[model samples]
Structure formats: structure tokens, C-alpha cells
Target: MTDSSAAPLRGGAVGIVTATLAVAAHGMAGGGWADGSALALLIVVSIGIGAMTALPERSTVLLLPALMAGQLLAHIALSLGAAEMHNHSLLPSTAMIAFHAAASVIAGLMIAAAERLYGPITSIVRAVLALLTPLPDGSAVGRVSMSVAVPSVDGTALDWVISRRGPPVSVY
Candidate 1:
């Protein structure tokens, strides 16, 4: 059977793809090579973030900084391009970059949280099923132990669901 642990990684991948495509579409309508190229680079950085989060074991502490760095790099590229073309001022560029960075970081965190939460939520559901229905041994109907481990802000909690039959079926 496929391991359930990979679901979060898959979700992160989907988030990255969505972010990249959104930026690509924006770049396409941006009406200049500089803007388009800058957005393209941002997409590359988003891919990196996706890759980092795609690992089976990822450190949540590093997520913020990684995302910030990616945003800063993309912003710098865009700012420089705009300056060379004289299409935008440094002040406005900086403001826009900050806004975009904040938005991106917030979106990334939300995506991560959703992905992380999926396991426990689904496990809780399954545990409920186990409790409500009889198993082959008829032991799970009334003797089920259901627990949901919610993650903390830093992602330093054991997020799992445990349903006991003859043995424990834990999804973490």
C-alpha cells in the first residue's frame, strides 16, 4: 500500500504549481520583458520552495525564511529591471515587492497548514467510521480509542489519529 505520509508533500507540490502558474499568467499580461522575466524568476523560486516542502521530512522553522529569501530575490530582480527601463520608481517597487512578499508568505503558510491538517482530519474521520461500524472481530464498535493530535504554530506537535482494533491503526 502507498504510505499516507506523502499526501502533504503532494499538496505542497500542487500549491507551488498553482503559485507558479498564477505568476506566469500575470507576467504574460504585464506588457514588458522586464516584468515578464522577473515573474519568471519568481516562478523558479516558487519551484524551489515546492521542492523543499516536498521532502518527506521538512522543518517548518525554515519555511518562513526560505520564502522570504525567495521573495527578496525576485523583488530585487524586478526592481532592478524596472529601474533600468525607467518604468517604475524605487519606492513604489519596494512597496509592491513587500506587498507581494507578504501575500506570498501568507499563502504559503496557509497551504502548508492545510496539507498538514489533511492527515489528522481524515484520520479522525476514519476513526469515527471504525467506531460506528463493526469490524471482523466486532471489537472496534464499542472499544475504539480515537485521538486527534493537532499541530502547534511551529508544527512541533504529533499530528495523528489512532484507532484501536486488535492493534492500533495510526495515521500520522
Candidate 2:
């Protein structure tokens, strides 16, 4: 894909991943889910975070901060945005904050590494596939074709095989 298309794709990927991880981490750490208006607001916040970090170049410096900020904002949004059923407190405990921080760092590192290596890895895979793919004409490069001497024209399967030499020969 072109660089222009790639920018939006990468941005969307980062945004979606950040939002998913934040929400998952919040729930996994025993933080109650905030539905209704809170959920809507969190989506907006995540999109904003993604837009802010949407650069064509791979940058851990930018992505890490964006991810960290997204996580923090998500936490606050969920904590304070819950309805009566959730009843979550606005202030999080030390452990909860620590969990979010740790998750943010680990996830950020992984995402950054993947983004940094994506281009090179994709090129390598494409090169390998190209090398392994067969030619359109079904002929091998630098191969010499040999003529076979037929004593007689016999209507047999062997005659079919003998007509075409090398890899393209078929007995069917």
C-alpha cells in the first residue's frame, strides 16, 4: 500500500488496540465497566488519542506517550462514568493504577516493536514468496531444452511424454 493509505491504517490499528487493551485491562483488574455515556466518551477519547499520534513514521516516542495517556484517560473515564449499577469510585487504588501503568508499558513496547518491524518483515516475506513462485510460462531459467530422437510415431502415452521435454512434459 502507499504511504498515504498506510498512515490511516496504522493510526486506526493503534487506536483500536489501545482502546481494547485499556478497556480489557480495566475489567481484568477488577475495575467495573462504565457503560452508556462513559463508553461513548471513551470511544471519542480513544479516537482523539489515535489522531494525535497518527504519524507516517514509526515512533515509539509518540506511540508510547499516546498509549499511556489513553490508558490514564480510559481509567478516569470508566471510574467516573459508571451508572448506578456499576457504582465505581472516581479515585483508583494504588494497585489499580500500578496495573494500568504496567499494562501500558508492556503493551506499548510490543506494539511499537511490531510497527517498527512490520515493513521489513513484510518485504522479506514478499521476496521469499516471489522467489518460490513458479514462472508464468512454466519454464525454468537458464535451462537448455534437449531434442529427443523418436524412431517411430507410436500412438502411445509414452509418445506424449517424449514430445515435450523437461519440466513441462506431461503423460496425461
Candidate 3:
């Protein structure tokens, strides 16, 4: 995709992916499902992060930190919105932290790899499609058909021709 056209898509994809991974990681770490308000907050924060990430040129290095930061922010939002909480502290337990970190790294790597491969994959798909498209019939290749207007003549002149194996033949 061209840089200009790709920005919005990349931004949206990054935001959504980060937010989703954050929620999933929280659940996997036994954080339970986030409430509606928390989910809303996560979405907003993720969008902001995504917009920021999209401004720069495409790079896996830049995206990694943005994803990680977005995940962390989302986790905080989730923690704050919970009605009943297990951990009273500001930070989660070491195990939970580790889980989120691992999830972020894995997800970030996969997303980055996909971004890298997207250009090549699209080109290949286009090439295949071009090859698959039907061509004009062979019989129509040499066929000639046309009309012309003669202003000098009182009636409109008709000029047409047909092509066969021998030579050009005027039909009118």
C-alpha cells in the first residue's frame, strides 16, 4: 500500500490489535473481563496511540513500543474500572505483569511480521489476478469495424470494412 493510503488502515489496525491484545492478556492473567466503562476508555486510549504510531514511517521497532505502552495503559484502565478487585496495589502481581509482557511481545512480533510481508503478498496476489483475467477472443483480433461522417456529401456516408484470411473487404 502507498504511504498516504496506508496511514489510516495501519493506525486503525494497530489501535484495535493493541486494545484487543490488552483485554485478552488481562483475561489470561486472571484479571477477569473489563466493565463497559473500562472498555470504552481502552478504546479511546488505543486510538490515540494508534494515531501517534501512524505518523511515523512504517517500522517494526517503533510499533513495538507503541503497542506495549498502549497495552500497559489499557491494563491500568481495566484495573481502575473494576468493581471488585483482587489486587489492591497500583501494580499487578509479578506473574500477571510477566503474562502481559509476554503476550505483548508475541503479538507485536506477529503484527510486525505481517506488516513486513504485506507489500510482497499484495504484489503477488495482483500478479496472479492479472494472469487469471480472460483475454479477448482470437477471432476478434483482426476484425475491423468503424464509421465516418462526410460533411461535403448531402447524405451521411457509410464506410465499413471486414477482415478475413485474404485481405480487407469494404462492406459499404
Candidate 4:
């Protein structure tokens, strides 16, 4: 069975890269890359959450930690650079790093919850579309006509264990 979650995972990765580039561009233009790095980390975390919603639940476990690590690394680099350039103390930088890491982890958990619900949400949408579609006989559809793929082993595996096509219902 072809994994349906692949598309969302790829999309999320792309989104992260795009957001990072956008942050870099803004930092360069404003000459505040170091100061803006905190904001950039937050933005990246938010974007990652949005993308993770479309991914499979199991993937979130790995992805979230990876994202957090990336954010941590970025935060450290930015903090050190800013401290060196401005000859500032490390106390404030340490505090900011802690905040960013905590925030990123919280965002990851939210994304995981969203990802867990994605399949059911998509199923409901498909069901609604089936009901809304008009029939030649002027009857409303009762069920999804397409083959529904059920994810196996919790939300981690997208292996289609059952493929069932509902009764044929004509739609105009």
C-alpha cells in the first residue's frame, strides 16, 4: 500500500526550509540577524507544527526532536554571534535559549496532536463531499464511494490493511 502520509511529510520539510530562507532574508535586510534569530526560531517552530499536522503520527516522534535540535543549534549560533559582536554578557542569551527550546518543544507536541487527527479529518471531509455531491436520481449520497485506506498499527503505519469501495452512487 502506498503511504498517503509521504506527501505531507515532504511538504512539511519544504515548508521548514522555505521559512528558514525567509527569516534569513529578513535578517539580512534589517541588519538584525542576531536579534531576529529568536523570532526566526519561533516562526520555524510554528511552521513545522503546521506541516506536521499533515504527517503520520509516528513520524512526529522523530521529527519533533530533530526540529528542536535544529532550533537549539540555531539559537546557540545566533546567541554567540550576537554576544561576540556586541560584547554583551551571556546571562540574557542563556535565558533566551532556554525559552526558545521550551517553546519549540511545546509546539512539537501540539503538532503531534494535530497529526493524530489528520486521518479522521480527511475521512470526514471525503464523507462530506460524498454526501454533498448530487445524483442523477436526485438523491443525496450516503457514504464515501472511493476506496478508503485505513492506517495500520496506530497512526504510525500507513500500510493499507483494508481497501473497501462503497456502493456505486452516481454524481452529476
Provide the TM-score for each candidate, comma-separated.
Answer: 0.46, 0.64, 0.69, 0.45
TM-score of 3: 0.69
Q: Give the Cα lDDT of each candidate.
A: 0.56, 0.72, 0.74, 0.52
Which 10 consecutive positions of candidate 1 have the poorest summed lDDT? 23-32
Clashes of each: 0, 0, 0, 0
Better of 1 and 2 by lDDT: 2
Error of 4 at 83 (Å): 7.6
Q: Of the candidates numbered 2 and 3, which has the greater TM-score value?
A: 3
Error of 3 at 61 (Å): 1.2
Candidate 4 lDDT by residue in tens digits, 1-172: 2235654754475346434633353244332455555556546554664465445453554655665555555544444555445443433355444554555566556555655666788889989988998556645578547887776557557546456778899897
**Best-matching candidate per TM-score:** 3
Model 3, residue 80: what's the lDDT?
Answer: 78
RMSD of 2: 13.1
User: What's the lDDT for residue 55 in model 2?
Assistant: 67
What is candidate 3's local distance difference test score? 0.74
